[model samples]
Target: MDSALDYKMVFDALVVPAAVLTPDFVIVAVNEAFLAVMGRTRADVLGHLAFTAFPDNPHAPNDPAAHGMQVLRASLQRVVATGERNALPLQRYDVETPGRPGVFKERYWSAVDTPVLGPDGEVKLIIHTVEEVTDFLHQLRRYGEREVDDTRTALEAVTTNVYARAHELHDLNERLKRTAGQQRQTMAALKEAIERQRRFVFDASHDLRNPITGLLTELEVALSEPSTDTHEILSKLLRDAERLNEIVADLLELARMDTATPGDAAELIDLGRFVVEELERRPLTAAVHTRTDPQVMVRASRIRLARLLGNLVANAERHTTTTIEIIVTTDPPDAVLEVIDDGPGIALADREKIFERLRRLDDARRKDPGGSGLGLPIAREIARVYGGHLYAADHPTGARFVLRLPLAT
Candidate 1:
């Protein structure tokens, strides 16, 4: 059993009201104690700007003491600027009555804001902790009015002790919660890495099995038959060997793409001109036409982008009857490129399936027996790595593969 410390559990267990905020003062999270004290739910406070969530009482906007938001903001800013803790004095911050719009209740609090510094010694987050002292203040005021000086003094002493203890407890809880959130994120990433490794192994073994078995069977046949045609046998063996090499090459390319980081060997290219030049450099198997807009420009690794385009065009050529159309244009923020072929149109259900690694439709298998199914998947991955998208969109009479890339500024 995994005995991981559940930081969320510790955070929720905190009895003192506490919340986590970004350096910009946006509420990132709030503990259960904070929710209970504020009469709020997590959904009501999380992701909201701190001041926006707990605005000053509009009914008492002109009252200097009632501007609790200003006090809190000043304290928070002090912590951020100094990278130190800022303890606020007793504050009169009123809260709107839950389920009663426009009705605010008078409240007082003793609060502290502490900065969580990053490696660069800059404030990354602030831990805000508060203890409500409204009831105690009211009682103390009553005692003073009744001339019970001794009792009022005793109550003030107790309140001081309580506030100090609450501050210590809340700071500890906040630290635990932060550590737990980071651990959870790390575990999630590790799990994803493991899953990818597992899938890669499974795919490699499954695809390699057929070619290896065929090669062994062919060798056995050549040995057993004394009069077997040497030239024909060698030719067939060479084709099988080449097919094996292609699959391995495709697999390696996919693995390389999986680990590749962006901006490696990247360059700015005019989309239309690049497409025209690439097509001219490569021999075509079908009649290819282009309607490219020279104004469309993008930043990408030239080699990877060329491979992506080649994969799309090659896929189209394999299934095309006679013609292939390539279109490059701009759609505001994106540079759009479409490779359309006058072939059997892909069914809606199979459109997404084609992009899956080693996934080939029945027609695709019949068209090119030597084809490695990694082409489309690699193309899509390349597009994704460069903050782009490649998908099979609906076509009137054939398959339409569209690539949308963010246009370079």
Candidate 2:
């Protein structure tokens, strides 16, 4: 029941676009927003046919204006005749203001035309409403395009950093390869030095063995027939020469231990019986004693094990002020040998360093000037080869050296 003048007041207060048209489709009234969008005064749009607003005149500057208006008029005529609200989906390029430049966006209008009936039941006026939504459509497209560009830039930076790291890694690998080659060359030089040392010791000992035996044999014969004073001097010379031979023999044996692969082990040997038999050979002024748990056996290189026990026993005898104790015992998994002497003990500081080659704790108390410092070293190395160690143990009255060898079942 609203007249065009009453509808004008309601539409003016609305935030949306509204227009009233005559039955002939002439625009009779328009709100402030619709007039602003058309870019003309209310005088230009009011009393103007919807066709004139988007005119078909040949003089109109925009060429597509006539066709666009024709299509819109046909849609509007159907809505007015049927008294229905028709939603028109206009494409991006279809909806545009005539005579406007640089304009973008396709506007969509949810338009409705309601025909006011007259007393004679004939159409008197048509009402059309439009809502402008161009800004919303424009912002959506721009944000999506910007997002794609940002993603592409981020991916490019990651790829560039990865490529740079790969190049740096390749350079580092090349340096490591060069360093490895140099190390292998150094190792080869060390191997050659070891071979030369072994050959010299073996050759020198081999060459001296025959001459030494001959010298001692001839000296013994000469001493038996010589004058008294000269015999004493010759006897002393023979004794000194024998000591030198012993040193050379010990050194030569140790040098061979380096190149010597352990010989296959023989049947288990009774360590106690072996020590007892070895004792009969040594002429000790003090009583030498041997004690062990019954059935005590060691699986070791026979020659090396014999030499290891010999060095310990002789060391104890050389230094003992009184009785020397050689105790062989077993504790479940390892067999231990303790050689005790009552002589002056080595200083606490020198205990560890005294085992090195040529190290002597007390040069003044040396009973044997010809004693080569290889005995303990040789024993330790032999123990290591058999998977064990030699350590100086606590002795309340004197020096105690303990040899621990792994017992094999």
Candidate 3:
């Protein structure tokens, strides 16, 4: 009999959700029960760090008691250090919905972490087991109502035992109060969820309407005017279709960014050199000048960084009169990159508003009717994810957009 096979069989046979992790918290393997409970597949989590695979919900409350990842990390660390099993208290850890980007389902869990020790008495691997308690918690909240009915029945039957009935009544009052509070919290959470969904639908539909309407109008005109040149009609249809495609692409990108977890694969990039290469690769209608400091370097994903730069440059091209300037410099612990244009500058009041989803100023609409209005938002999100910021700063001549990122250590 193969011992390894026997071990695997026993591990999979367990009825509860269980996963095996390395000492460094990397998910080495997960059982069927774990996959079912976590709403994930093996490919989604295997070989990834535990925290990275299941990140803490960014929308969760700021209370420490609601932070499941923090508690779980501490428990795992303790088990590794002491080489003993540890049971965690009830935790409210939400999980992302399977196949739905940017959607999370509320969840509660009761978990235990046990360490496997080697011959030398050091921790080898950690076995993490969890039981979902979300339903149970909901049921507990409803217990007060059920208890009240039973108490009323008892009070009627035990009229002679006044003292006993009085104590029962007092306890029931406390339970009812707690249940009322719980119900209020649940209602608040539901309201917030609905509002978020409503905003998302509205934003997507609002931007999509223009391109769809234009496409339909073009098709109708082509049908009504048979003498119109075939080449011109096809060109108009193609342009409308491309606009629709770009809007859809940008929406999908934003959704992905909303649910993305911080990655550990960042590399040090030379900001000045990177900017020069990106400009040379892309064709620009306006002349672009560069004032780069070679000493400015930052740690980031190359692809995402390039996208951020591209968005800034594209935005500048849309509004610049003739020339745009790209400046790279360092501000102590941060690397600063600024994109300045020679056209009309952004008003102080509209600086923040421009970053809102699908928000377009009057001038912007007049300049680029086909624009999706998502480029600046996407660029800002990327900057935020990298522990940086993108903002419009006061400039003497035109709109100046600045990006600041932590310098590479």
Provide the clashing-pair count of each candidate structure: 0, 0, 0
Best by lDDT: 1
TM-score of 1: 0.59
Compared with the true structure, what per-residue lDDT tens digits does model 3 show for residues 3-118? 45677778888899999999999999999999998889999999999999987767677633356677678779878976878776666677778789879887777788999999
Per residue, candidate 2 scores C-alpha lDDT tens digits across 1-409 of: 5454665567777766778888788898888877665456788788888877755433332523223355457657755675544443321123345667545324433344566767976667777766555565445556555777665555545444443453455346546655876898899999988786665556446445544765676677666967556766576667667766776776766666677755646457676676777778767766677787666777777778778878877777777788788888887688887888887766678777656644555631368545666688788878888877897877887688888877767
For each candidate, the alpha-carbon lDDT, in order, equals 0.86, 0.66, 0.85
lDDT score, candidate 3, position 363: 92
| Reference-based TM-score of each model | 0.59, 0.49, 0.53
TM-score of 2: 0.49
Q: Give the number of colliding residue pairs in candidate 3.
A: 0
Query: In model 2, where do residues sit more than 4 Å from their true spots?
Result: 1-230, 262-267, 363-365
83 Cα displacement, candidate 2 (Å): 90
Return the top candidate by TM-score. Answer: 1
